[model samples]
Target: MVTSYVDEATGLLREDGKGSAQFEEVVLHPRVTVADASMAEAARAAHATAHDWCFIARSVNFPVRHEATVAVG
Candidate 1:
């Protein structure tokens, strides 16, 4: 799984303006290698389950998007 994000800040460079920063978006790329192509759906489902159970994902106010890929080896 690879995680990437974008951060946005407002008024940070100004001498008199207050600085605030927050995540604009987060993306999770989950790759699964399975023995057969038929298992791709299961792999994707598992990733969804894991994401639902993740505390950090649930706690974050920003959007957490998933890009799941499955490979048959």
Candidate 2:
């Protein structure tokens, strides 16, 4: 899940007429799974790569941060 906090004073306006929007903060939660313990480390590393490759994330100038969990099921 992803979440963002918008400044209420702006009334959810997209911009200040300056093309700059108000996004107080953004948080991302991503979950990854691996087949076994041997692949756990690699799966964790892949998460970073996946984030880097996200088009929306890469296109945004604002910082996009995440809290991720990797599990073997």
- Candidate 1 stretches greater than 4 Å from native: 1-19
RMSD of each: 7.3, 8.5
How close is every model to the real structure, measured as TM-score? Answer: 0.63, 0.58
RMSD of 1: 7.3
Query: lDDT of candidate 2 vs native?
Result: 0.60
Cα lDDT of model 1 by residue, 1-73, tens digit: 3232232322212233456556766777766677767776877798789778878778978767667777777
Instruction: Rate residue 57 of model 1 by lDDT.
Output: 73
Ten-residue stretch with the least lDDT total in model 1: 5-14
What TM-score does structure 1 among the candidates reach? Answer: 0.63
**Mind giving the per-residue lDDT tens digits that candidate 2 earns over 1-73?**
1122222111222567877867544557666666677777776677688778878667766666666676776
Residue 49 miss distance in model 2 (angstroms): 1.1
Best by TM-score: 1
